[model samples]
Target: MTLMRQETEEIPAAVARLLSSAPETIAPVAAAFRAFDPHVVVTIARGSSDHAAYFLKYAIELVLGLPVASQGPSIASIFGAPMKMGHAAALAVSQSGASADIVAMAKTARAGGALTAALVNTVPSPLADSCAYTLDIAAGEEQAVAATKSYVNSIVAGLSLIAYWANDKPLKTALANLPEQLEKAEALDWSFMLETVSNAQSLYTLGRGPTMAIAAEAALKCKETSVLHAEAYSSAEMLHGPVSLVNRDFPVIAFAARDAAEDSIVEIINGVIPKNPHCYISSDKSADAIQLPFIATGHPLTDALALIVPFYRFVEQLSLHRGLDPDKPAALKKVTVTR
Candidate 1:
């Protein structure tokens, strides 16, 4: 815990402890919504959680085939019209479970007859209060100003819901092994990311499976810690229009996983590496073939494990490479409040 805590002041050791909470421990949460066949899902969150929402949305849709949208705080705060509420269930993701505007939005969705849920670290919070179901991240107390364990845990929890809801056997098995994979990812060397990302003007993180959310998480780390202009996209989406522009000038980060989409995603990576040539890769396998395990999420825990490892290292190292303190980010705080 000290090794995890020493890197950032606001981040406490207890928060990192949440990483090991078994998903099966929260099996009751998955059981609670067994009856719900939501037409769509709308996620309400801020900053880091919002980014996690993006990845979760992609994962749920890719596997469950249910439409999912992440509401902008402004959209839910000012519009007053509940779009996600009309036909979909609402999932509010927060570490604090106290963001005023997102809570308000989730309440609005609940009042509109849509089912509601909260993925949170805090118990007895406004966000949890508003939803009928609460999927506790059980990440315990997050001590770091920058969210590490809770954010990853929330993504894992959400993926569990998606996997269970879809009831895809192979996908479920892959996700179940995620926790071990994450541990492996944590041990992988990431010194190269610091050396490489410093000189790049722009970077891209690409993924397809639940790892698409991993790409988004990676991009957030790049910007928050290093001030790099980084963006994430689905591997297929990157090849659609953005891929044409990828060349030697850009460094591409691929979030590869053991999902059905791996082959096509690998193909997309093949296409980009030849063009951009500055490819950074993360996985839960031997570092021999790819760039090595950049983070811990590549371990058996699929989404959850990957959530902890690759992006955390990316952010931590990017901070070191730039001589910036990871403890306090530029113009950011432990909790974000919206109007």
Candidate 2:
């Protein structure tokens, strides 16, 4: 088996380990968040880790009613700009904790008076050392060039911290039951949509709110592992210009969770169904397009994360079918240290 597939299967266990150690690993960060009570939150990350931060963006905004923004690492690493974040908090998500630009930006956020925390797999790396609170994802060694467990664990750790900080009972309960839900998610067969996109050279992935981040992560994995050209856009954003690219044979996948945004996403999928017969969607609601099975985690946040596991399984097989190695994508490394 490819290391990517093996690591993808390890997602549930990795998340459970992080959840089991939450008190020791995440409580202090939650305490810090409560004390800071910042007016704004900034996220620092890149690649798959950036997608985790994007998921947290909706969670923090909707649950905590605080605005969240993503900061480009180049602002500090290249422009050497000064930031006024004295009334804000920063969350840096990194698997390796070794990226020079990410570490530099975290240091900059700290110097500017933001209470900075890092969710990282490596405990004693530079990014962790630079932050005031370092929450280890506890994902262990990830061998594949395409990340699986680390990406899932990063969001799990972030959600755990958010649940504790916001004191949201629903989100906390959903997170507590997430391991079982994730296992069910893994067992789902997303091959229903595979036959549509496996042979296509390019496709479009659609989602809104938190699940848009999942779509973005999925699109990145498709390119890295399978070399398929995929693009992700918000359900609302797609209709503006991107929808023009859709045709009967063009594959479209819509990621809709059991959240308030489900109907809106489904509407987009239904509207496009007549033009594009290859469209597929995931939701409890019935739509004209093909419906993909999804495990509802009882909360919007957890449901969003759960949608990705089955997609991961599908993409791994798709990569193999396309004569590609998901474990060793060309011109990529496990830890990308860029400035």
Candidate 3:
């Protein structure tokens, strides 16, 4: 058990390198899409890729306030068959670039007069061919059945796309500084979490604002790495019914921001804490927990993207410590199929 020696440290470093890769890897794309001021954005993918795409939609709309939607079979499958993509930006998110449905949607997006882009881990997949512009994540070969490297890489790549589109100098600077923060976070100890969260059979995470999208990533990483069942809900949605799950043993992670709503968000955390379940909180402003200095959309998304690395390291270590093979969780595969 040399746990620290595992790929834990390399995870953040590799993701950092991938984030900076966009300047060089996607320069051609930068030149290609300079003219299109796309209004409607639609995304297509499956599993983790799709999850990252949802995060992207939120990021783009949140910062730019442009409308974005996830393109389903109605517009995607019909293609030129009476139903059209209708002047929207289409993003095909795929790890392998082999998913035909994603490829077709990218083409349909182009056909419908919307500029299309491919956010992918693989450089030369079919999905890339359909999109006029592409950002290659360069995550390398992800050997695990559930994604680790590729998921973070995808988030970074998506951030780069939004940053580039907005010509955001602050975003570029923030991303440059994000890697070191993640390195520091990875090296830190999380012994408290193992005793508090590892053995738990179920967990819940909540976030609002930009963190609302980040919650999805946190939930996915929790499941993939530790195999502890976890669910993510928008902060508002949790009050609807999910709040009833609170108990002393269950762990809850609340994501709050340093904003006008900070008081309300903290109140929510306080309300959840007395429910007795162990709780962890994260914010760029918090003094006690992991602080990424969430710098709005620019550096924060990059930092938020890095947020998963520490959790991954903790969960992966817990998996091995518990005599479970994290590389192969039962009944799960890297790529899933659906009809």
Task: Give the winner by lDDT.
Answer: 2
| C-alpha-based local distance difference test score of model 2 | 0.91
TM-scores of the candidates in the order shown: 0.82, 0.98, 0.85
Backbone clashes, each candidate: 27, 0, 3
Q: Between 1 and 2, whose TM-score is larger?
A: 2
lDDT of 1 by residue, 139-257 (tens): 66665577777777777678777666666666566555555555555555666666667887888888776677677777877777677888989888986688766767777888776
Worst 10 residues of 1 by lDDT: 7-16
lDDT of 3 at 179: 67
lDDT of 1: 0.68
Q: Rate the local accuracy (lDDT) of all candidates.
A: 0.68, 0.91, 0.68
Model 3, residue pairs in steric clash: 247-277, 248-276, 248-277
Give me the displacement of residue 129 in model 1, in angstroms: 1.5
Candidate 2 deviant stretches above 4 angstroms: none
Q: Candidate 2, residue 253: CA error in Å?
A: 0.6
Error of 2 at 331 (Å): 1.2
Residue range 1-339, candidate 3, lDDT tens digits: 333235455666766777766777765564555456665778887777877887787778766677878877335554434335545677888888876667766776787777788888777878888887887877776667666667667767777777776777777777667667667767655556776677678888777755666577678767765677889987777778888987877788776654444456555666776675476766543344333323332354554555556666666777776677777777877655332
Best by TM-score: 2
